[model samples]
Target chain A: MLSKKAQYAFRALAHLVEHYDSGPVLIAEIAKKKRIPLKFLESILLELKKNNILESKKGKGGGYFLKKDPSQTYIATVIRIVDGPISLLPCVSLYFYQRCKNCNEKHCGLHDIMKSVRDATLNILEKRTLKDLI
Target chain B: MLSKKAQYAFRALAHLVEHYDSGPVLIAEIAKKKRIPLKFLESILLELKKNNILESKKGKGGGYFLKKDPSQTYIATVIRIVDGPISLLPCVSLYFYQRCKNCNEKHCGLHDIMKSVRDATLNILEKRTLKDLI
Candidate 1:
């Protein structure tokens, strides 16, 4: 399941994608339009900015905008940045792999199945970008 | 991400699948072998039993076993019982569908993408059963 944080991030990103060339969008406007709580959305956008997915301007007409073209922003990238991992098991994760205690991945049935699941999920997430969302 | 509860459930179920038709296996044995905490595994097994995926016997030689054949238990069934929904978005879930607050599902791009994701995930999870785990 997508975390509340990741869901909000997607909602906020979709809004930004819609306003891509129109310039910065106010945080408050996104909050009101997307129904995300203001404080939570602020943190989500800041995290996106820190990860270089977004940038902002200050003063008059100041607001947030995508740092890259929506076509270049893969759904998988955003999900990983906000949600930590795509795999259900840490052992099968491509970017967040970790050895399960007292378990051998080479001989684990769960590992093999989860790896397939991760691959299947990534097949869709990696191919679709924010541009595709629009 | 899979909840710790769901992960433990899979590990326990996989252990049961290995010992299917042999006899009821001790919970303590599964806990030690799977590296699951004993207390946690107890609750998980109880939940699976409640969902009719597992059955337990009491007294000497007592333990838990699969209620149905390993091949009859779909991975998606266990996951949905243990972890709620497979889809990232509530609106896209087939069995656990819920309307997204303040949003129209028909015109939502995230909804469409998530529906695709749900289908891809279900494609793998629904076809594979406990028999395939071993």
Candidate 2:
């Protein structure tokens, strides 16, 4: 259900949680551990850092680490930072909801079905903290 | 989340369900009605037909029809026909799972988390039938 970017981002965040007390994790190391492409992981980390889900450094021992404890980070928060809205349809999205242009009724069957999918997916993503992923 | 192919297929199938008692729906007509690219939808219906979720007619007045009543056609069945598998991670996949290469234990943390996601997503998609989409 997660996007490729979101999957990679969650995996990388997990690695940091597993090693958070040690120090920041190098993007390359996280990529290797997670089996994600180096280039793709780099951009994901940058986005995570930008959103403050993660923080980074630039020195010899520098890399990326969580801005908060693993328990403090929700998987949904990290996912949205990397993949935008998680809802399959833009109109059913909590962050970007706008009724679909062709929806014939306020509770159109199509929209209702999509909304069920969205709500079910979000309930799982939002309840679990990054601590659970680790 | 729905794949692009699954999204197109669902729209096409909904069109078919909407006009089932009528003659076959032209690919172009369904595409236009649903706002999907004609060519992309052509392939989706082909795949759906291969899986027997849909049946097609080759000559004039022939398009596609559900293999069974719309209520018998689960959204999950159509989605699986159009998309390889829905689970995000390979290990948690019901159809293609073979533990992650790096997972240390049978009930490893990562798999457990992904399993929860898969289970939750499947529960919603599997419950809704194509009848709901129509």
What lDDT tens digits, residue by residue, belong to model 2 across residues A26-132? 99999888898999999988888888888988989999988898888887787777767777676688986656565564756666877877787778778888888
**Model 1: per-residue Cα lDDT over A14-59, one tens digit each:** 9999999999999999999989999999999999999999999989
Kindly report which residue stretches of model 2 are placed more than 4 angstroms away from their true locations once superposed: A1-5, A25-41, A58-62, A96-99, B105-107
**C-alpha displacement of A35 in model 1, angstroms?**
2.6
Compare the candidates by DockQ and give the number of the best one: 1
What does DockQ give for each predicted structure? 0.69, 0.50
- List runs of model 1 lying over 4 Å from the truth: none
Writing each residue's lDDT as its tens digit, candidate 2 over B15-44 gives 888897887788989889989888988888
Output the TM-score of candidate 1.
0.94
Candidate 1 lDDT tens digits, B13-117: 889998988999999999999899999899899999999999999999899999999999999899999989988888989999889885578788778888888
TM-scores, all candidates, are: 0.94, 0.84
